[model samples]
Each structure stands twice: as C-alpha cells, then as structure tokens.
Target chain A: MDRRNNRRDAEGSSVITANRLLDGRIVWLAADGQWSPHIRNARVYSNVEIEDALKEQTASAQDNELVGVYGVQVSLSPTGPVPVTSRECIRAGGPSVHPDFTPEWQERPAVSPA
Target chain B: MSHAPHSSLPVGHYAYDEVDRTFLKQRVAQFRDQVERRISGALTEEEFKPLRLMNGLYLQLHAYMLRVAIPYGVLNSGQMRTLAQIAQRYDRDYGHFTTRQNIQFNWIKLEDTPDILALLADADMHALQTSGNCIRNVTADQFAGAAADEVIDPRIHAEILRQWSTLHPEFTFLPRKFKIAISGSPQDRVAARFHDIGLMARKDENGRAVFEVYVGGGLGRTPIVGVKLRDDLPEEDLIAYLEAILRVYNEFGRRDNIYKARIKILVQALGVQEFRNRVNAEFVAMDRARYRLDEKIVAAIQARFGVPDFDPAGQAAEKLIQQRKADRAFDFWVRTNTHAHKQPGYVSVTISCKPAGGIPGDVTSAQMNLLADLADQLSFGELRITHLQNVVLGHVRQDKLYALWQTLDQNGLGTANVGFISDIVACPGLDYCALANARSIPIAQKLSERFASPELQREIGPLRLNISGCINACGHHHAGHIGILGVDKRGEEAFQITLGGAADQDTVSIGQIIGAAMSEDETVDAIARIIDTYLARRTAGEQFIDTCRRLGTAPFKDAAYAPA
Candidate 1:
C-alpha cells in the first residue's frame, strides 16, 4: 500500500493510528491497508507520506473501520517503530497498573513494507 | 428481588412518570440511530464527538467511558442491578461511582452504549447532561432523607433542578461545565460550598423551607469560595433565583479564554458585590410565574419519593451493645462507617470502597449485585453515592446491622474507614483520564495501604484527604484537610501538597500550597509527616482540620519540608 503512495518529505518517521470505531481498540495502519492491533506491524511513513497514509486510511474510516485517525511521532529501531511521547507510549502500551491487558512491550512482528 | 420483580417502586426513591419514561425511550432510540449513523458511514467519528458528549459518552485515553447520572446520588436496587449487569456485560466487571453522585464504566464500546442506555432507562436513569459544557449532575447530601440533622429533604428540590436543566436550550452550551450541590442538613455533608451553585436548606421564622444561596464557588486551578447571593430566598422562588444567577453568568462569563471560563472566574472578575447586584437585577426582571416553584409541584415530587416508615418505638443504639462487645471489628466498622439517622432505631451505613489497597470508588459487578440484594432486604432498597466516593445504605435498622456488616465483611466492602484518613478520594488520573498529568490511584493505594490500621485511623480521628490527577480538581483536593495535586513537573509526575482546607458546614477554605511539588513517594511521606505533626499537636478530641487551623499550616508545612 505504501508503494502506491511512496512519497517521503523528511527523514523522520511516524505511524498512522486510530481507535477502532466499534470497540475503540487502538490499531495501527498496516502495510497491507488493514488496521492492525499491534503497533509493531505498522508501516512507518515519512512526513510527506503521512498525508497519503491518512488519505488512504480515511476510506477505512469512511467504511466505519476506525475513527480519530492521526499520525503518532515515532523513532525507528531495529525492532520496530516506537512511540516518541509518553502519552503515545501509554496508548501503545496499556495502563501502567494493569499490565495483563497490555501487549508485549518489546516484541516485534512483521516488518513495515520497506 | 425475592419479594417482587420490581412491579412496585422501591420506597424512598422516585418512580418515573409516563412522560419521563416516554421521553427516555425516545432519547434512547435517537441515540441508537446516531450511533448507527456514525458506524454506517454517514457521520465521521470526529463529527460525533459533540453529539455523543450530550448523551454521556466521553472518549478517554484508552477507550470510551459512559457516565450515568444518579440524580442527587439516589438510586434503588433495580438501578444498581442494571449497573451491575452493564459492568459485567458491556465493559469490565466493575463500575466507578464518581464524586458527583454518578457511576462511570471505563471500558465501554461505542456500539454497545445504546443497549446500556436502554437498560438504564428501564431503571429510570439516563446519562443525559452528564457530560459536556452544560449543567452536570446536581449533587446533594447522600443521607438527604435519613440524616438525623436534616431540616428539609433536598431530593425534591434536586429533582426539580434535574427536570429544569435536562435540556435547557439556552444553557446547553455554557462557557464551561456547571456543577450545583445542595445540602439538606444544616451540617452540609455534600460539600455544597465548593460547588458552582451551593444551596443550604434552612427554615424561616415561620418554619417554612428557605435556602441560603451561594454563587460561583468552585474548585479548579483557581479555587474560590462561593459568595452568598441570598440570605433567605423563599423556597417557592428557588428556581427563579437560580435562573437569575445562571442568566447573569451566561451573559457575562468569559468565553474567549477557557481557563477564565468558569463561573468562579466571572464572580471574581466582577467582584462579589457587583455580581450580586447584577443577579438581583436579573431576578427583578424575570417572568415570575413561569419559574415559580409551586408547592404543589414540590409536594408531588415529595409524594413520589414515599417516606420510609420508621418505627416510633424502635430500639436505639443500646441494642448493639452486646454485639459490639462480641465483635471488635464490627464495633470499629459500626463506629466509623455508620452514622446517626433521623429515625430513632436506624442508622445510615456508609459502604466505603477504599479497602486496604483497593481502588477508590470501584465496585465489582458481584459486589454491586450483593449490595442491591442487601439494600432490598435491609435498607429500603435505596443506595446513595457520597461526595467522598463511597456508597451509602440509608435507613438500616439497628437490629439488622450485624447481618449487613457480616455480608460486607465477607466481601471486600467492609473497610471501617468512612471519613478517616485512609478513605481517600482519588480521580481516575492518567490510567484512564486523557486530561491527567499524573496517576492518582497508585498514590491513593499507597496512602491507604500505609495507613491500613484501624486502631491508628481511630486515633487520628476524622480527616479528609483528596488527590486530583490534574488541576481540574475533580477529586476535590482544594477542599481536603490534606490535599495532593498531581502536576507535570518537567515531564515527570509530581504531587503538590496543600494544608488547612476544609469544605464542611462549619468551615470552607481552600488549601494553601506548601513549598514545591514532590515525587509520589515524597508525597506519601509528606502526608505521613503532616499527620504525625497533627497527632503531636492536636489537643484532646480535636480533628486534623481543627489542629491545622488552630496552629495554622506553618507548623505542618515545616514538618512536611523539614529535614528527613
């Protein structure tokens, strides 16, 4: 999906994210155009491509897949894209107290559509 | 439930009339359609924010939270059962009772909310006006009908306010949210003085009901006491007088800056005397007949809430002597959690949700179900949510107290700390709230666990400790004897300490800041040190606030920041 809208304006990377409309589960824009629950599988986009990613995912939002779509600033590591701010990290991770419901913190999944 | 399937309205609770039921049904259907539209590609989620807020659906950090209004903190077993079912089915297994006499389920789905709301409507409850910049829930004394010192029942008046403010078109979009609290008793158990509009019920020279109205008193970043707008506004003119004040605020309250938007800011900007003059002028020009609170209407509402039949010759506290002697734990629980009732042989029992290290204001569905059954069996099937984030089972017979205590003790509900130091009120904070700068529950848990001893709490006497995640002061930190405010200090969570605040009937003062903010651990230690200072300085039978006021916060502040 990123190949179709491959445009990079800056070196810095970010991921498009939103909460699913029905249950409000946090999801990230996967490389295959699906909103994946795990953030590690999201396709990281550059500043210019963020707009394309948002426009592409807006169809999903229009189709009632997810809502409140926005780009979260992230840092690219060998593992995956990590959230930059504390609030986004908390959004990526569950509540500090309730760790049982949180996803694996350091676990990595399918790589972005490089 | 054993006796009936709720075919009859429970005693001491208001039953919905046909019009109320029909309106609720139509509102639910409309909300259902709205949710459907948002999902079916007609309206985007961003577009649905304002619409959802009117129906009490707020988007928090992780998920959506639904706040259901418990008007004046009054509900029956049937309502409690519905809340339990919703908590168990739609969201998590628990629901949080808020400081404003409402219940909130944290992890709600947007799709399931309509069903949850319909269930609430069946119980004669709704989430209407629970959110948004409108008139929020009108809180009142939890023990309104049962308090021994109550001069007038405030529930009828609160119900009247609920009816008037449900969908007032003019006031729907205020500069900011508005909160009003009413205290039925002379003792001001509901912290009426800290609300946007405070009404204290009293009788005139002829023994007819009247009120002392206080305007623009609120707690936030700028905490201020409400100014007295009227000394003795006649009961019949209650609605009219409130309209006058709200109209003045709607007209002159600042809207350009959100920080300066609360009525308190307006009241402070114009000064008390000038603001009072303007409100009085508005009152003089109002259409009198439309807003006149008819005694017949009040009587009708009062009749709907049928008075609980109390035994004239009921045995008093002497009946519990043997039982108290037998069970020491029950004795402490009774002393701390129960209060004097207007009835001769009954008492109002406070079921404190603050266990040793449990979450404040959180009750699991199982506990809710049990409490509902117990209320039906023992306490007239009525429940109340207090300002301090505890539940009240009002009007329990002295003889049946042991049975109630046993059931609560078996569950985790028997915490023997009602107004004690450990019965802390903490907001949802960063864990659930999107606006919080720090977490409040962990601090509350640490404090409650550190001060878990019943004997120590009894020794400390009465103390109100509150923590707010942000400066919004939802936890009423401004009114606590010892207050903890969570702030973002250079990206790290820090707690600010305040001393010498009290929101009771006798005293109403905002706390004074003590030095700089501290870390979470430092905050816990500072509170402990403050308590130690109080314990050392307090005279015989003097409470924490009295000691703080008598010596001022200088000594406590010194102790808090002293070498340690």
Candidate 2:
C-alpha cells in the first residue's frame, strides 16, 4: 500500500483488486475494507488514499481472503470506476464469451472477512 | 505370430503398481495439508501460488483451473469414468483436452481441489509437474504401439522419462518449463520437434532400438525448430544423454528474463554446435553407469503395456462392408477417422472432439461416459488422448467399427474430421485463460463452421490451422501450415498470420509471419484469401504445406495483405 515503493505510475484513480480465495470470483476493495463483488461499489482511491487502500487490501490478501492481489488503474466516470486497460475491464466484466459466469450475472455477495 | 486369447489378456493395460499408487497417495496427502495451511491464513497467496501451481491449480479468469496430466495420453476405462465423475462433481460438466495431452477443468474451486486430487489419486493420476518451471508431462505418439510403421513402443520410454523427471530435485526449478515428446513412427504425430527434447525411436545397424535426439525446439513468442543433437544414441544411454542436456540448460539457460528463459532462446544465443559441445562435455564427465538404464528395467516397464488381443485373420467383417455401402457418412468417417493397424482385423480410430460449431477439445461428462463404455466394448478398455485434441481407440476391432461409429455419432463425438480443417487445435484463450490476450475459441468455431461440409474439407485436404490466444503458443500456432496468433493491438483483439510452417515427418520448420495483424472480423477473410491463393497457385495435387513450400510465403503474404 506504500505508493513510494510501488512502481506503478498512478496517473488516475485506482482500486485494489483480487480473486476471492474460495471461488476465484473477481472482487474489489470497498471503502469499508471489505471485498465487494461489484466494481460499482469499489472504493476509488485517488492520490494519498490510493496508498492507504492498497495497504489495507494487501493486508487482507495476506489473511488469505483473496489471491493474485494487486492494484488496477481505473478512471472515475459519472457511472462508476471504469478499468483503464481492456484486460482489467475483462476481469471486472467477466469473460467475453460467457457472460452468465460473471459475478454480476451470478449476483455474487460480498465476501466476509476470513 | 499367433495372437493371444482375449480371456487371458490383462485386465488393465499400463496399470499402476504399488509404488506408483503409494507415491500419488502421499502427494495428495501433502497437497491437502498445504491447502489447509493456506486456507487457515498460515501461508500467504504468494507462497501458496507456486505450491498450487506445482499441483496444477491455476487461477484463471473465470475460476481455478486444475490441469490433470494424462501420461502419454493413455488411460483405462475406469480412469476415464472417474474423469467423468470428477467433471460432474467437482468441476463444470465438461473438460478440455490440451495440446500437451492433458485434461483441464476450467471451473474449479480452491476449497475442493484437495478432494478432487484425492479422486484423481484413486485412478493413479495426479496433477504433479503440470505447471511451474519443471519438467512437464512426457508425451508420445498417440498411435505409439498400434501404428504399423512404428519401430518401437515409445510409451515405455515416455513412462521411463516420466518417472525420471517426476520430482527430480535438481531440475525442479529451472530457467523455464521444459517439455519432452517422443515419437516411434517416422510421422511426427506428437509434434516432437516443437518440444524441449524430441526423441525419435530408430534401429541401429545392429538392429537395436536407439533414439535420434533433437533439442531446443519450442513455440512461444520465439519459435524454433529443434536441431539434432545425436543421430543414434543407444537405448540404455537415454537417461544419461537427457541428463547431460538438461544439466547444460540448467546451468546456462537464461533466468534473468522470463521472455528469454526457454531452452530454445538459450540454444539460439549459444548456437546449436556450441550447445552440443557443452552437452557432449557434460555427458563425457558424468558417471554413465549410474544413469544408464538396465535392460531388465526397460523390459519390466514394457511388460506393463500389455498388447491388445487382435483377430489373427486380417479380414474385414462382412457386416462392416455392408454398412459402409449403405451409409455414406459412416463410410466417410471410417475413411478419415480410422487408420490401418498392424494387427489383422483391427484399426485405430480417432474420436474427433471437434464437432461443427463446437469448441475444440471440449468433452461433456456424458460423452466421456459413452467413450468409456465404447472403449470397454469395442476397444481394449483403453483410450488415448491425442495432442491434436482428439481421443483414439487404439485397438478397435474392424467388426465392431460400425457399432462404435453409431454410438459415437449419437453422442456428438463422431465428426469424421480427423486431419481435416475442422480438426483444429486451439488453446483456451481469453474465454477462460488469464494470460490470453484475445479469444481463440470463437475463431476456431468460425473456421470449423465455414468448413463444415465434409466433401469441401476433404477437397481442401489436410490443412493444419492452429490458433493461439497469445504468444505462449499453447495452440502450437507456430507449427501450423496456417498459424494465427492473437495479439492485443491498441487494447483490442487482433490476429497475426503465419504460413509455410510444418511439424510432420522429419521436416520441422517454424512459420514466418505473413503481414500486418488483422482484426478478429478480418481474420477469417484473410484465412480464406490465403487458402484461395494456395488453391490458385497449387500445381496438380500439392497439399497445403507442399504448395506453401514450393512457392514460399510470398504468394500467401501477398494474398493476405491484398486490397480489401
């Protein structure tokens, strides 16, 4: 969560993201430090808040609640936080071929702390 | 030679012994404990990722993917049934056969992996060394023992290599993942040349089995055809030679850069002759007796692969000929899907998983169940998974062929496109894979649909079109006559074309890139244009690869990049 040590060039708003450890469902860190399935509910961290959020999410990752934890570049729009890269967008939206498998389609609930 | 009676035959060909069973059981127990630790917050994700990877559990886009190794593509009916059960219980109701002769379950849960692994252990199977930078599954010709022209059963050597490489302390963490493929016949069905080590079985002047070794061939971002390291090494020295080569690679292969870590890049940088020199030096310095394989050990392993009982008289059943005359589809299926067997009144049948508009290499649980029954009834209760993403009934009786075909056709497993354009090899790209840059399944489906007509596919004749979602080359795009590589261009899916590459016989060559990358929509048109160019430029009865060789890539490149 320390931005000074991290190599990412934080040009825009960002969020900590990971796949849930149990089911590998994509999740984002909410403002309340909980893992939320909905990107719309994801806490968009800007400037100094990004570092704090990343640290909190990393600690959560260390608790074995999520796998492949990292920060994703996102831009805050009128609707929600949009992923900066197509890869991240795919991860957030689910695989292009099977929309039914997406967390949104499945109506996944936020994961409680492990 | 007189054939043995079916009643006296072994119950299971290549059945696991006590040691193998114990080893798998122990591995499952260990992994289960590791999983418990990870879940209990003792082991972090960073620490657990590699351990899970070693067990073939990968976190893909949709869910955790568990890759179960099908050793040399060989499996018994009971094992096949268990695979079906696992598909139904632990994963989605289907599994995908990979190019490396493994089965992948896409939708897996981390909590259930230990239980799933225990299930696999019941069948004497494990996901060991399927991932991570280790010696992966050792693949061989699917038609190894059954092919008429094969000089030796490559499966014995493959199994030997598997035992040698499994959990080898020194080579466990290498510069990159290593692959080894063995082919018994002159025809390169296993794509041996495109692997880290390619062993071709040959007989020397003294009429003893030996290997023609080739090294440093791979396909990822940088594709290279393997160079011959030894023309004729004694069968006993197989392990020693392999050790020497691996030791050289382990010592010098690049580890600083992930992209340049494969043995092929190392071979390229050092030059083949220099690499060979180092390997030869290593070989000479090592104590040969320690690594040299004993003839008795080889015989013991070979004995495990029990021969299928075949009818002595090499005559087709009267009913088969009659059925062929009546049903045109059956006739076509037999002509394309079945190959001549060395034994009389027997043939090897390829069960094509690539149905029209279906995802390549996908098999439902019901299909697996049906195949298990078919394998029990028609074949010798054994089936082989081919690298081309098809199943092979290696010892099906000619008399029972029609009945098998009917059952397969009913289950959507009988497509009759074995080597045709529809028999495509594609990787699970962006749809399921986390590392894929673009989607590959849709492209494969589109091509299969476009070439659905059996007559047209036959007329086009023997085209190997492989598609990869990324430069990882899991789809073996580099070896295809027409290769399509999916790349991310400006944050959108685009495909690059390659032509004039082949992976058959002894003439292994890497394809050259054709032109600029094309959008997903434009890719099919570009493929058609290249095929049309081949059709126009071909002289007489030249196959796709033959025509490409004669004219080089100029014609195909021109056609691919031609004006809209």
Candidate 3:
C-alpha cells in the first residue's frame, strides 16, 4: 500500500485551503473548526483525488506504505501562502458561515482519513 | 426496545400506503445515496444543496439542521421513536418542532446526515422542501379531520399538494420559496391567510369539494392576507390552479434581489387583480388534458389518509372527565388545553411547548419518545404540529386525558397557556439566524417571564405575542396581537413594538409600530406599560385587541414612546 496509491484512504487527497469573502471579510476554518489568521498555508485533498492517489500504489508498498489516511474539509482567511487545492471544498460559500457567531465558536472535527 | 421487522421499501412516492412498511426502506436508501454523493464530492455543492434540503438537511449557523416533516402534523409511535434515535445518535440529543408541521435537528455534521436521513426514512418521514426556495411543507388545520367545525378533511388537499409539489420539475427553481396552507375548519387556527397560497375547503353549488384560493399573503417584509383569487375551484382543477400560480410567479417574479423575490411581493407589485389575471392566463394555457389528476390517483392518496375510525359513544371519555374534575391541575388543563373533536368520544390534545421562560418548539429526545408512545397508545397513531409550535394529539379520548396530561407535565410540555399571553412565538434571531438584527428569543423569554404567573395569563385572556429578530419576520410579528420587531440602530440593538395585529378567522390586522425604538431593557418596560394601559382601559370582557381598538394606538403610543 503505497501512501499515495491507497484507494478509500483520505491521506492521498490533496490538502487544499480555501479563502472566502464573507460579508466583506476573509475567514477560514482550522482542522479543529477554529478560525484565525495565524495558521498559514493549510491544504486539503478531496476523496476522489485521494482514491486515485491510492490506486497507483504498487504491490511492493502494499503492507508498509499507507497505514491510514485522514481527510477533512477546512476553511481559512484569504491571506498569506496557504496550500490550497481547489478540489476538496465542501461548503463552496465557506464553512457554514453565520452572521451572529464567529468561525472560532464552531466546533468542527478534523478530517479523519476514512 | 421492541421493534417491528424490517419492511420492504416502496418504489415510488405513490406506492406509500398507510400500512406499508417497505417504502420507508427504499426511500431511506435513495436519500442515503444522495447524502453519500454529497459528502463524497461526487455532486457539486450547488447540486447537493437542493438534494440535502429535500431530505431536510440545512447548513445553518454552525452545523446542518435536519427538518423532518410531520405531514399534516400527524406522527405515530414508531415515527417518533425514529426521530428520538436520530436526536440521540446524530443531533444534539434534542430537536425543535417548528411552527410549520415539522421538526428541526440542529448540530448535525455533514457526513452523518445520510445516516439521519436513513433513520427518518425508516419511520416513513423526510424533510422534503422544508427549506430552500420551494413549496414548503403543506400546513393544514392541526385538528383537521377530527375538529367538529371542519367541513371536510383538509389533509386530503394537503396530500394532493404534497404529491403535486414533490420534486415538481417546473416549480423547483422559483424566484423565492413558497408555502401553501389549507384548512377545512372555520376556526382558522392554521393561519392560512399568512401562507403563500391558502386553500379553504368548501362546497360548491352542486355540493362537491371546491377550493377557495387566496394568493399574495405572507409574513415577511410586506405581510398581506391572501386575497381571493378564486371563490369556488372544482376539486379536479386543484393542481392546475396551483400550477397556474407557480408559473405566473416564476415568469414575473423579481429575481435580482432576494428580498423582493417572494410571490407576495410579485402579487403586490402587480396588484391582486393583475396577478389573478396573469395566473388565469397561465391556467388557460396549461394543457388541461395532460395534467388533470386522475380519479384513481386521488382515490389512492385519499384512501391512505381517510379519517380514522372511532367510536362515537361518550362512555370511554366520560369516566376520565369525572376523574380529572377531582384534580385541579388536570381540570384546568382539560378546560383550556383540550379542544372539541367531531367525534364525541375523542378530543384534541394540545402539547404546549411554551413553559414559563423556556425556548419555544424545542423537545428533548426523551420527550420525543414519550410523545411517539402517547400518539400510538392514546391518539390512534396521529399527531398534529400547530403553527403556534405546539404538538397536538388530535383524537385523544377523554379517559386518557389525565394520564396524557401527567406525562406531558413531566415532559415540561403541560402548560395551560395555549393562546394565553405567555405562549409566545419567537424566531432564532441574532443568536443563530444570519438575517437577524437583534435577539428575539430574549425578548420572548422576558415577556414570558413577566407574564409567568398562569393565573395572570389566564386573567389576561387570549393574547398573541410574536417577535421577529429583523424585518424578515420569521416569528410572524406582524400577526401578533402584540408584535415586537428587532432592529439594529447605529451600533446597538433596539426593539420596535407593534400593536393590534390578529391572525384569526374574522379579522387579520398587521400590528403598527407604536413609536421609536427602545433598548432591550426599555423595550420590556414599554411592553409592560402598554399592557398596563390596556388592562386599565379595557371594558369588562374585552380582550387585548378589543381594548387596543377602542382606545387606539394614541393612548399606548405616548406610554410606549415617552422618554424611551
């Protein structure tokens, strides 16, 4: 199981961070659902890409290559160099943004590789 | 927990039978597949949103909300159990039953939604079109077939609309969402006039089922009672008439701005007569021969929803009545909380969600299970969710009243304040809603606390208090006897008070804002002052509205506005 070629595992998916304009301000969600400008250059990969990446793993790497892949959909502020792959976006309009509560208040789970 | 054997899922919506268990299985699988696709990114967000919405999953505030429709507010034991399971397993161990005949589970994750949908589908329920701009859950008199004043069962029409609107290809993408309500009863408790389309069941000259159609009425921004578009439309043309209206709305509605997109705005902009004519033209152009509902189809749906059989003898309930009379609490509940049923042995039971100063419409998972059991054992597997956010066991026997009341009391739903002052309707204003300017639940809670004394509320007589976070009016402030609308003034939250609005059969008046905005604390004081003035000015036996009308806003205006 080559790390990049194991299908059904979330790790092989590209790590993409999304920058969104919500009510005129840019914000994003961390792996823990916290929103801050500090954590820079986070990336995520979609399930499809992860699956494709896993399929290419050869027999030589079957046992020791990919133990488990974890995947999560995330959001972030639109600034700095964030490793963002456009494919893994879950909520296109940003992570269920609300007018009342800040992104930090939301408790989102880290994308665990399935 | 005891459970029935798994049943086969039905192939199509039309295959649903009252006794059929299999259809639930297939429907759950279908919705589950849709959910998986959405999560897997196989479907685009745009594509997935509608799919999720149809299954009652809404991405709101912090998490996904699953709104399960209780068609015509009817729910049985097994269905309730399913909801309870979803609450415990997927949601925040609680669900909120909405003013419309539906329940919303907040705090659900996107990945777990498919499993929730599967659970609901197991109970023969789904959250179809509960949100997102489409025909909403068809509401009817909660006491529909059971109410004594009902001319005919409104559920039949509701079912018809449900079928017509389910994945309706043509009207799916409307300018804005739509809501249709029907009532067979003359009491008008469902507030049909406030819906996008209100259908009142009546008989024509030939003594056949004819629908009286009303259009352009809604609660948001410009609230107007639906004007009579057609006095007596034959039963066969029901779907056609609805189609005509939808087509007219789709064609002429303003889509540039979301606020002006509702059909009500279109109707208002075009004028009622012009709107009616446009709809009429569309109706005439419609291929009557193709869309005309077949008698067989109507009969099939009607067969599943026909009134439940009940014994007319008063012998069963009479003993319970006597027993209840001995207990003061139960007696009070029986007198005010229960409603008259068409059947002598049966009665309509109101499950009040408003208790002292609690959040309206919320029910714990434990309560959901109890309600389901109660509906099964006592109410013949039938329940109704009222527009007032209370669940009604529509056909409870009088003998079961005491036991039911005790259960409801233990569950925190036994408030003898159905239509009393403390039973207020408030939206999830600034707390959760994106559109809210100020908080509504706090104002509602304050009002409820101020009028917490049951005796005081009883003395106040029938009063409706509706609060909206913003002008969007989700709480339906415009229809309340005393309405409170929240506004954001400068950088601070302010409340504007309105008076003399009523959502009843005889008259429906929009409450006019009395004066300038007041701070949250000052708002409560102002409301208390107005109530004080009404109490002082009212003639004996005159209710809040009657007093307001007699003295007018002049008297209350000065008190509410003076130095506030």
Candidate 4:
C-alpha cells in the first residue's frame, strides 16, 4: 500500500488550502502545518493521507487560523505542486482580470497568469 | 432595527431618528462581539457563518467582501462621502456598485468589518438584509421621483416595504432569498417583472393609486417573469397583501434542493391558477387589521421623501443646442446618458461607470469624493445607484449637464455608453466570486474595447448586453437583449450566448441560448456578428430587440456559430 501510494504521488498530489481568517487571503498548508501564501511551497500529501489530514483541520483547530479549509487535488509538475481544477488554480493565483491585485509569490513562482 | 422617522436628513430617503440611530449602534456592538467570538474559537465557522452572512459579510475569492445597502439606491452627499472614506481607509481604494444597487468593498479584512459597519450606520446605512435567506434589499426605479412618465413616486411604497421587510420575524429564514422591486414609471426602468414580487404603481379605473402586484418571478438557473397576482390592489392594503403572499411562500416553498428552493419553482409546480388561488386564500383569511398599511403611516413616509424644488426656467434650449453641436463627445454623452425629468428643463444624467477597459460598476475613492462634491453643486445633493451598475444625478438641471459631463470625463467617470453595447452589466465572476465558473470582467473589458467607437455604439442603438459569471445569475443574464453566461466546459473557460431577451417592463422575456459554449475571444467575435446581423435585418427605425423578434434567431445563431 505504501509503495502504491508513493508511485501515485510521483504523478499527482494533494494540498490543503483555505482563506486566512483575519485577512481572508488564500493560504496553503505547509510542511510545518503553518498557513502560507505561497502555493508552490504547499505540502503535498497522497490521496489516502489527505483525507485524514483534511478531516483533522476541518474538525479541530478550525478557527485557529483559517476558514473554508479543503483539500485541493494537484498535478506533480516539474517546478512545484499545481492545483488541478480551474477554481483552485484561480484561488492559488489571483483573479485573472486584476493582475495588479495579485500577491507576489515566494518559494518557487506563480504558475498561471490566468 | 427601528425605522427612522422623518428626521434631520434633507434627502427624501429613510430618515433615522434617535431611536434608529441607537439601535444601529447597539447592532454594531453586538456584531463586534460576534466577530470576537468567531476569532476566539467560542463560535465555530459552521455556527458563525450564518451570523456573518446576516451582517452582509461574505468570504469571496481573495478576501472578505462587505456589501453595504444603499436602500432603494438612494443616498445623500454625506453618505456618498462616507462611502468614499471607507473605501480609502479599509478597502483597496475602490468599491463596486452592484446590479442590486449596493456597494461592495472587495478587499475587506474580517477584523475591520465591525468598524466598517459602525461607519456605515452613522451614515444611516447598514448591510443587514443585503444577504441571508430573508427578504433582501427592496429595489425601485432609480428615476422614481424624477421621471417624466411616472404617475407616482414609488419610494413611499418602497420605503414602507423596506421597513416592513427588514428583519421581519416570520419570514427571516425563508426557503430562499426573496427580492421585491417597485417601478412607478410605465417604461419600467427597475426591471420589476424579474423579481420575486414586482409591484408597479398605477391608477385604478377610478384614478386612485394602486399596486399591480406580480408574484414568483426570479432569475438564476431558472429565469422566469413573475405572474400577475393582483390587478389593482388598494394602496392602503399593500402590507396585508405582501404579508399574505409571504405567508403562502414561506409555508410552501421547497427547502429540499437549493436549485429548486426558489418561490418560482413552487409557483411553477402549483401552476399559475392554483398559485394565485393559494395566495388569495391566504389574503382573505389573514387578520387584515394586523397587517394594515395605515394612511397616516404612509403619509408620514411619503412626507419624508420631499420632492426637489424645480426651476421653471432651467437650461436654455438654444444654448444647449449650441453646446451639443459644438462638441460631438458632449452631444453623444447628452444623447445616451440623459433621461427625461418630470420637471421641464431638467434631466436625470447617468454617470456611466462602464468606462473603456475598466471594470464595470467600479469607482475609485477619489471618484466617489468628487461625485459627492458634484452632487452637492450640480444636482440636489442626492444621488441614485441604478440597477444597471451606473450612478444617476436624478435631478440635474439641464444647464449643469455640460459642466458635469466635462468633470466626469476628466475624472474617468464619463463614458457615454448608457443603453449602448459597451454598457455591459456583469458579475464579479471567478475573478472574485467563489461561486463563479469563469471570469466576466475581462470579457466585459474585451467587449468594451472591441466596440470602442462612439459612432459604432450609436449605430447599434439601445441594447442591454448582460454577462453572468455563473448560472447563479447575479448579473441578470436572462434579462439582457443578448446575454452571456460563463461556464466551465471541462476545465476550459467557455461562455454560452443567449439572444432576444429584455428586462424592461413591457417587453420582459428570457433570452434563449443560441449555441454551444465559446472561448473568451470567440464569444466576443460572435457578439459582434450578432450585432451585425441585427443591423442588417433591422427596419429604418427599429432597435435591436425589435429586429431580433421579427427576424427570429436563425441569422444570429448562424452568425454566433460562424467560424472565427
């Protein structure tokens, strides 16, 4: 089961994403379990692990830092973990219309201008 | 919250007495405490969501959005200035005027929401009833008092409705959101037919003021024009009539499925005759005295909305003609952006928010402050926010229009695109709204740029081009003469086009979807072709919708699906 999960992670992964409570900025779960603005540095979890992890975040310490926390399916691209769905991709990036309103990226780089 | 009696405010709006003022302060304090509880883990997100929503705070794509109601789209200069100050202080230097005649700050922090609400309350405004399942903000004709065609000022009824509907205990948690609109003008500028309850003010056979009440109309996944429930409901029985309709809807509306939860579905399920019968039964059985809209109460509300003192000798016709002929841009602005005023020599000037390549309904803090100053000087120190995402100086004397137009033009507020193809009503789609499937603002900008020529817009004539980011229909796509709905065509951005619909009172109808979804560029191109087809098929004096109805959709459909 572990070997199979490892093989699956090579092609695709998942990350936890939500809006920071105070400012309502989009944030991703990092390796240290801290909410970070940069999506590229988001900690990638396998499908099996993410289900349990998201449950914990959603149920416990929900109001600690974030709101609307949910798991985002991502593609294991060369540079970083990328959100798979268009909606997640938009949340990770800023509004396609307002490039000026988008936050500057850290860790790797912003993947989609859209 | 208590309704403000006719008090200090000069503007003919809902005046706030000391009691109303105190109530607002206490409400803000309570909300502040609720926010603290939410942050401190005393209230879970699940528990706190409804509370925050009740206060009109919504979590959008990037940040918290605060929707502040400009009740019936009316506000004083002081209120407008306060809105500017809030935009400058808490938000990203701008605010968006929505299709429902409310202002939305995009980048609000959750912590700052309480303070913002406090600031708004001081200006005789609140976000309450802007969201939630309860009856939302009551909309009326922007030109209610000023329109030449108006037989009555609907604001009296609108204000009464606003007070009655705000926090009504029985209807607070209805199956879905309920919207009500009132239009005094025969032209129906308010799109009254497309609301959950549409009330049109008119005279009965005896020439007494009465309401032609329409019920169960809505626009969303299911776009429907309301059915007439009462032909001439007596003016005094307005409250009782509305109460009966609400009681029936509240008890019977489906709560099982969100999509099927609207009162329209219930009305459709029961059939028109059966629905009317149910409403009539409730109307007849209710304790009529309890819900009576007393004449004294109505008179007091009507007195609060004092009419502006008109100038008989206003702008000189010859001088205005000279000014129009001198500059073509000024002439275009006058032709497209001005509406007829009841008072001669005066007109209601629409300050177009849909500028070239700018986001529709967006106004910067500087622009807001300037407009407030302009309202003070040019108009009667009052402004109206139109349902079409524009601002109206409803009582502008014709003489001041040229000067007002110039100032607006210099400040990027003057675009003479009202009722033109470029004046697109759009939603904050996937760009900001979490529920949207694709972005709408960028597409609107592209369309504006494509049809940038004032001459081309003039040639196209009056057309309502509305865009919705999703099927939720916040943008009122179904009402547009030509509508565009952005959809997710399996991970790709796509837009479905619809043709031959109008939201105006007389010609109200839903647009039919023309073809399969198109990419952003293709959608713009198709719209251009559709316009061309209309131009080609139209008679000498015919408008877009008339030509569309006559020619049918065959030519436009072919034009839309044509290879680009």
Error of 2 at B460 (Å): 0.9
The CA lDDT at B402 in model 1 is 92
Q: What are the per-model DockQ values?
A: 0.26, 0.32, 0.04, 0.36
What docking grade applies to model 3?
incorrect
Each model's TM-score, in the order given?
0.92, 0.93, 0.80, 0.95
Better of 1 and 3 by TM-score: 1
Estimate how well candidate 1 is docked, as a DockQ score. Answer: 0.26
For model 2 chain A, where is the 10-residue window of minimal lDDT? A1-10
Clashes of each: 0, 1, 34, 0
TM-score of chain B of each: 0.97, 0.96, 0.92, 0.97
Q: What residue runs in model 2 are displaced by over 4 Å at the alpha carbon?
A: A1-15, A31-33, A45-51, A74-84, A104-114, B1-13, B313-318
State residue B107's C-alpha deviation in candidate 2, in Å. 1.4
CA shift of B530, model 3, Å: 1.6
C-alpha RMSD over true interface residues, each candidate:
10.4, 7.3, 14.5, 9.4
Please identify model 1 stretches exceeding 4 Å from their true place.
A1-14, A31-33, A43-60, A74-85, A103-114, B1-7, B312-316, B562-564
TM-score-based ranking, best first?
4, 2, 1, 3
